[model samples]
Target: MSRENSLVSAQWVEEHLDDQNVVLIEVDEDTSSYDKGHIRGAIKLDWTTDLQDQVRRDFLNKEQFEALLSSHGVGNDHTVVLYGGNNNWFAAYAYWYFKLYGHQDVKLLDGGRKKWELDSRELTDEVPDRAATTYVAQEQDRSIRAFRDEVVAAIGSHNLVDVRSPDEYAGRLLAPAHLPQEQSQRAGHVPTSVNVPWSKNANDDGTFKSDEELQKLYAEVGFDESKDTIALCRIGERSSLTWFVLQELLGKKNVKNYDGSWTEYGSLVGVPIALGDEPGQADGKSA
Candidate 1:
């Protein structure tokens, strides 16, 4: 069996393309990219369709998750390698969801699709045939996910990181250009949450930074082993990248992703929200 870690380089994936035990998944917000060209034999997993609960504002249930995986020929024993466009935002989000459902052997392609393109690697339009297999996913792990009430209760006691851009964090923009519906009635971060854009965790080439650099980046924001951390973004997609960096790269054990994120938290009635560029405060008032 091939040894697996939280991340694997593009070259590593290239060498493992033929490994029957390794399943390559291309998870992207834009499925059109997969149709154009993708890593050879890679199966496309559309983040919006395959992973999400179409009617609800949550991920698919355990049975739905299993069906999705089985249809993609992903048995529990296979080493799932994921990568995609938009700096691997949805890819990392998928990684987090896989873990939440207890898929132990999941890994992300280092630098994601950007690094792959930069290296001038081979791409193919031919989709390979994959046999369906029975996949049993563990029950959804609530420990890694935080609900809006839990976030509200932990307001002053826990560490919350808002991994959106400065404009969104400052209440200047409702949401990103592409996801207009993800916007909240109120435009701001959760009260007392720190603004630490998720992009800081990666290099310009889309690769994650070195351990030393990652340590410093979080330390600057007072991330310590003692604090139980919760991270959020527009709809909790981008923050999954931060969640992976903190938990997988930094080895912080008590980190959770508030998947409900700003859309749910900011729109819900009676929830106290913080606005503006200020770093810390319990309410929208500047600290």
Candidate 2:
């Protein structure tokens, strides 16, 4: 990764295509997407399989996550660049997941494969190879995330950011990832949490906007670039994107992700849920 919080341009990624320590991933929620085509030298990680711990539905544990990275030649010193076949959604989430496991030298492929392929970038249909290796887990950063208990305590705090869609925020459309009964406990958002949906930071094709635009976008939602913020979504993927925008794009050093997400929180019945107020107040829910 670069020395500062900013995206690596498409041109930059292309220039380092052959660098050994650089690992590229083409994420597909479905395997068919990767089978069709992907960037040359890009390995595929089926998000539903490789990137997550299935039973947990959260990011993999440090040991498993580190092993997966090591197998792909990723180390604390290696530069891991991730992209996606389905827009940049899963790609950015992968970036956020690795970061949560405390990997610092990682980056997102700006514009993802969509923009790269549109620009006539080279691609490959060959099977990927890997050299199995052991990777050490760096100390995890917990501040960038929050569990239900911590979030409920933030009733008067203004640092939590809910990166779910407006409809989800309003309790109009709950994420199907969770069972319907689990959705009933909390109908809105954590008290005081801002509705800065992850999708708003990117364009239609899943590429992020210019930094100037990002500054204003986040500022309008009351998330200054320098403030300490915790991002969460229905699961963790959406908030991971928010973590990327805030920490990597806008250069916010204090941003973190709530990896437990709704999958974990929604199951915690009566653990303090708010409807209208922000995260800490527990006065309201997402709606």
Best by lDDT: 1
Model 1 scores a TM of: 0.95
lDDT agreement of model 1 with the native = 0.87
CA lDDT of each prediction against the hidden true structure: 0.87, 0.71
Off by over 4 Å in 1: 1-4, 177-184
Leading candidate by TM-score: 1
Mark the 10 consecutive residues where model 2 has the least summed lDDT. 276-285
Clashes of 1: 0
- Each prediction's total of clashing residue pairs, residues at least 3 apart in sequence or on different chains, is 0, 28
Write down the RMSD of all candidates, one decimal each. 2.2, 3.6
lDDT of 1 by residue, 57-162 (tens): 7789999999999998999999999999888998999999999999999999989998999999999999988999999999988878888888888787788889
